[model samples]
Target: MFSHRVAALRPSPIREILGLVDRPGMVSFAGGLPATDTLPHPRVDLDPTTLQYGPSEGDPALRAVVSENLRGLGIDAPPERVLILSGSQQGIDLVAKLFVDPGTPVAVENPTYLAALQTFRFHGAAFTDLDWTDTPAAPLTYVVPTFANPTGRCATTAERDALARACTDGGVTLFEDDPYRELAYGPCDRTPIAARMRGGSWIYQGSFSKTFAPGLRLGFLAASDDLFPRLVMLKQAVDLHSSSLSQKIVLDAITAGTWPGRLTDLAAFYRRRRDTFDAALHRHFDGHATWSPPDGGLFFWLRLDRPVDTRTLLPEAITRNVAFMPGEEFYAGEPRLGTLRLNFSHADADATERGLRTLADLLTEQ
Candidate 1:
């Protein structure tokens, strides 16, 4: 028979809503997928012949590119330490499978990534949250730190210091999941918590899905040497290796000097869109809504001042042809009824303003 944990995990809420917004003309801010138009053209000329099995670690060129990027982040990731993943999502599962045992204590942000929670839950890890004041024990803690999902809260430099101290003191390992690190649009100043701590104590996972193209499904993890080999073996058992083809393509793209230019352009582009959405949210739904401007990231967490539960509001909003993620889906146990997340990446300038207007009008009438 199959494992019980396999049956216990729920499908990701965002994944479930993906198809719903696929109707011919619907505007989507649901998926965390990056804007495809921003990715650089593939530079690696695929031979169509070398499309076979890749190295268990990753492609040499890709590894080199990743290693260079890691150095920029202050992590001394050798090529051997990098294991290319299908995406950062798969890296989450691999970590969970290797580090999380059934009933083992795992720490997570109060409002964390739904998929990471699902991955750990499927691996049968028991989760405890890092709350506003609660200090956890020697557990494995998971955090987004920068532009946290559904909260738009970037961990402050002070919070980063405190988190590092907690992890070091509690003898806990920190999983820094930073997919939206490069999308900063506002005043952002915080170093990675992992960078602040001792080596091997913090496991950092990053993805090209947000910065580059998601279909490439490219992600890399930087950890201490102790954790790298086991994750590589776990990855080898799972998917053997992330596609060599994708790796080469990304490598070529990065080395060609397009990735950096595109990154700056992408950040500026998203920043404008974010500012527009923030203004629209204020102009249309100012008093009744509450949200912090996301300094860098795709989604903005919004809390409605009234009793209008997002779960309750979704059906009506959908009928009226507007939709957003309910805040509760990001929670571990009970969903936050009045909270919701609005993704500003997918929508263009006009669509963003229009979508926010529709939601605001609906709320005003309600």
Candidate 2:
């Protein structure tokens, strides 16, 4: 029999959606995956020796690139502070294992990343969604500060200040998941919460998946000196090390000075998709839909003018050759009706346009 922790967690909604959207003619934007087409110069020729089992921590070159990138975020940490993971989701699991014991009260964004929820739940952490009725009296809090998954909302400077101040005052462990930080379509105004953190209690997780390619499974964790070793141990237990081959690929790519240009090009590409989809939603649904224009990232969190039951509508939409994961799965508490997260990244311009029209028609009929 499985452990109680395993029994308590629900299967990830993204995994369930993966199975349902396998049919032809379905345009599914449920997962936070990059469009494979946007991946810059996929294959790299490397010495066969690099493919062998590497160090338990990541390769040195990869660590340097990761450390250099973190410096751009205002985190002044050496390569020792960086621990590479198979992906950022692995970073989430590491955080849960290192810090959370059973019944540890961990505060999360109201609608947080569902996969992160699954990872934390599997580790037996008790999750409480932050209700901003008044400022929260800290405790351990996890938030996606920029281009948040499911909501596609970036925190304002005031919001970031308030959160950092609250956490500092309350003596909370702050974990910031910042995978989409580089995908900003517009100007960025706020400083990172980790940068503003006073006592170095904050932990920041970032990924090259969206900026580079997810297949590489490259991501790193930047944490306070206090939490670093525990996270390293967790990584050691999980897979011994992240892939040395892929890390080298990333190292070469970043060193070549092409990564920044690639990210800039991706920003332009996704911005067009965001604009086109937003315009199409207005043309088709008129005043029947509302959504925040994402300053960056692959998703737009949309709310219908009329209350729509996504639970019922999802299956119906799939039958009509359309598919999207429902919004209910993102919330830790009661599901938000009339809300949906749509991705504008994976599909091409033509496919994205068609998918929106089909989705709008399906939702209207419901």
Candidate 3:
């Protein structure tokens, strides 16, 4: 017999949509996958020792690299505070394991990242909307402040500060999941909320999945000294440590001095894709749907002009040889039927145009 947690687990709707997109001639705007062509594949030299098990906290060299990167983001984290995981998604799971219990109230943004909802739900976290004025007394709150997934909205500096203050005053721990911080298209001085908070009040999760290659599955969590040990222990229980070879490869890549230039190129490439997709959306469905043009990131969260259940519309979109994620999966509570998220990063400009046009035509028919 399976445990209740296992029983409650449902397959990710987005993952299911991704499978449908594999059909012949299907153009997808569904998955939040990074553009593979933009990823850097620098040569990494490894010794036999690099293949062995590594430190539970992470490889020291990799932690130092992550620490330096954090400093660039205006966060004052030292190598000692960093715990590397398979990916930032594991960071969410570790946090949930350590903190959340059945019926534990956890504050989450409305229509937040679906995987996060799934992670917290497995731990039996009772979700509530994050509100500064009436902040949830939950011990932890999870937020993707920079170019958040699905919506692609970045929280302003003042908003970050307000949330930090609320969390500090409420004794709530903040989990800042920042996978898209480096992907901004234009000038933005948005800093991590953890940078402004007291040392122990926040834990920050950063990933190479967006900026670099997702297949490497490299990510790190920076927490206060008090919280670091517990996380390492949980990580040890999970997999002993993340892949030793992958850590060395990431370290070598960053140390090689190619990372900075690669990041700039990645940002520029994604910006073009964003523009192309934005133009297509406007040309095809200007008045039929409304969406905030993302400043940076992979997605455009669109709200249909009329009430239409996206879940119901998905089959029709697939029938039209275009696929997109329905909005219901992104919500922790009752979902808004009119919203849907479209990702432009993985698809090329021409494919994006074709997909949007086909999608718009299908919606028009409905």
Candidate 4:
């Protein structure tokens, strides 16, 4: 028999959709996967120790690299404050394990990252809606402020400041999940909420999965003095340490000074995909549906003009050799029938166009 938590859990909708998208000739806009061709394959001269067991806290060199990256985001994080995780997803799990108790109040964006909602649910976290402009009085709140997954909406500077101030004054722990911060389109503001907060009221999670390669399974968590030690201990209990070889490779690649240029190229590549997807949406469904052009990130969250349930339409889309994420899966509360998320990063321009057109035709027929 499974535990109650395990029993309550549902399979990830995105993961389930991935299976459907793998069919022959399927044009998938389902997963938020980085373009495989854009992934970095740097040749690093590995130290002998890289193959051995690493420190539970993570590789010191990699932590330092992560610290510097945080500094670029205006967060004054030291290497000692960072804890490496197998992925940002693991970081979420650890946070939920440490902070959330059964029925503990947790605030999240209305349509937050689906996996995060799942993780919090495992720890029995009671979800509340988060408004960036006004902070709710919950013990912990999670946000993907910049180019949020599924929705791809970025918060304004004032909103970031307000969130930071709320956490500082209210003693709420602001969980800033920022995998797509660097994937912005142009001169968008990306001031981290941690920068505006005083004291230990925020935890920031970043991943190389978006910037480098997800297969590496590398991500870092920067916590305030109060929470860093507990997270380190939790990580140690979860997995003695993350992969040593992966950390070494990431460290060498970032230190080689080529990573920044790669990120630039990545942005340009995704921008073109975003444009292509947007054009298709406008051309096919401009009057039939409503959606915002994301400033950056991989997805476009569209709301159908008519009352069409996306969950019921997914199998039909797959039958048409196209796939996307129905938006009902992203919400922490009630499901939204008309909404769905389309990923533009993994699919190339032609594939994206074909997929969107197929989806549009399906909607038209409906």
Candidate 5:
């Protein structure tokens, strides 16, 4: 009834846990779904053109907006080279489509994005260190170096430089999914490693979901000359292009010059939630578990002092009216069962404190 891929496919733990997150009184730190207040309510001037079918490559004006954004991030992204996607997640599916063949060698981070692992595994991509430079190089590598999901860890300048150098030197194409770049709390450099690897085979992906609106479902990838046209063609086969109405609304927001400030406003608003989250971690899990207080982004990745399986803790967490993603779900290869990820932006101060307290107590008992 189903294909081999579908037969073996495992549901994403992050997505699976979301069902439990919404029950009354559940204090969830599971999903990366942004807080409601941070979203933009831009007005779209709905002409027939806005409702009508648009180019498979996306609305040219929106592409230009993405182009300018890439340039600002230190990548020389020409508007012509940009491929507009339904979301950055679609960009992942496209990259996998273009590169992965059954058992084809691909690399990814030790504990990378869960959805990426799911997409690649379905497409039959073999795992390498995937963390740039650590493993033997593969033809394609996917990474979220900027405030990565689940872990909320941003790669440092030296690490980025090394990854860039390694990819360029290794002749590997990088898929840098950087949706969280603009969500930094204070001044932090968020340069794409691909910026340094110009002319090298690479793909840089960005999303409007985090900064603008998720409903727009807008994301993009900057592919090299060889891969750009293929990705666009593939996207055409997938959905015939993203929503024209959504693209126009985002374009209107940029034209009205509210997009830049929206990014700033998001950082400022989420900073309070982040502060609450980091404080709770330090207070409750300092000795029981170790975690770096993220400077920005939605998640705080933690590794328990004991080798307790986080997967086993979810039922109890849900029973306790709190939820989180086990750290093991993020890994494509060997997993650190002691690890788990907590999201900060969606919940309030009291929820963060309560959730952390609940999780800490569970760990303390371990």
Candidate 6:
């Protein structure tokens, strides 16, 4: 027995496949898990407030630190507008609570984040493409403009400007998710859409999950005046507030002088992994699949030049002790077959190369 809302919920495809990943000697590139070796351990100096109940809007000092980081990236965020979340995942859930009514229209990018899709589906939102112009403006437009997951495609600055202008002109709210900016091989390729928006409603979400550690479970969104208060209200209903100890840890890392250097070191490390994977891809699957190399982020998205469905490829891959994400699960509507996502962040270079060669051999048989 369950509520009507429960009927709408579906498990995340990534998490669903992760159960198969924990098998002995399985080299999983399936989940969006960050490299464990790269995570930072900031000095922990806790205060009594960390043990006490804190504001649902988040700790003021941590919010200020998050606000300042956003400002440096060109978003016009102040500490006042920033509502700290348990993670950006919670941010998505709170957003679903605030704006998504049953049958409400929501526009999301094709092959978008599966967790976001699952959350909105739980709220009964009908999904559409980002260009939801056939009807009146969709209430929300969600995207990860910089180093997007699954695909790892960064939007061009021109494209970002056009999107900002269109959303501002159409009276729609833009939700720009930017978690992978700090992991860029070079300078971040695109300016934040929030910074470029011309007097329009928007939300800019950022997280410590990618660059730092997901266990911290700390992230935030900067919203406009109209949306921030209600988001805060929903957040209060959900968890009252995020972990005060997590807030202290991240705030310490950011405020301390070591964070920037750590980011630089991380970017270079991910870049090496990306290069290793890219080389193996070329050596093995080059003609069998087509893909654009991601400048940053965890995955390499591929459109296989064959007739096989990736959903059918999983069981065989499991037997081979290799794992990846089938791309169809990322779609809101019917999926485009023959596509998949491979993660380059978790395994070491030699393991990554061997895994890719095996994946390539699998693709070649079809």
Top model number, lDDT? 4
Which prediction has more favorable TM-score, 3 or 4?
Answer: 4
Q: Write the per-residue lDDT of candidate 2 for residues 1-366, one digit (tens) a residue.
A: 877776666767687777765578778877776877787775778899788888776887778778887877687567888888898988888888876788777888878898888877777677887743334533578899888888888888878877777776777878899998888888765367888877747788888898888888888888888878888887888899999888887888888767678778888888988898777777766666788788998898888887776778887777776667778778877877888888878777777777778888887666
lDDT of 6 by residue, 1-366 (tens): 889998756666678778876677778889877888997757787778688999999999999988887888788789999999999999888888888999998888898898888998999999988753332258888888888877898887777877888888888888888888787875555688889876878888988998888988999999877788898999989999999999888888887788888888888889988888888889888788899888878889999987568989887987898999999888989999999999889888877877888888887775
Worst 10 residues of 5 by lDDT: 128-137
Worst ten-residue run, lDDT, model 3? 130-139
What TM-score against the true fold does each predicted structure earn?
0.93, 0.94, 0.96, 0.97, 0.95, 0.95
Which scores higher on lDDT, 4 or 6? Answer: 4
RMSD list, candidates in order: 2.0, 1.9, 1.5, 1.3, 1.7, 1.9
lDDT per residue (tens digit) for residues 157-194 in model 1 = 77787887777776777788888888877766556777
Model 6, global lDDT: 0.85
lDDT of model 5 at position 181: 86
Worst 10 residues of 6 by lDDT: 130-139
List candidate 2 segments past 4 Å from native: 20-22, 131-138
The C-alpha stretches of model 5 lying farther than 4 A from their native spots are 131-136
TM-score of 1: 0.93
- Model 5 backbone overlap count: 2
lDDT of each: 0.79, 0.79, 0.86, 0.87, 0.84, 0.85
Candidate 6 off by > 4 Å: 132-136, 186-188
Q: Please report the candidate that would top TM-score against the real structure.
A: 4
The whole-model C-alpha lDDT of candidate 4 against the native structure comes to 0.87
Query: What's the distance in Å from true for residue 352, model 1?
Result: 1.9
Model 4 C-alpha RMSD to native: 1.3
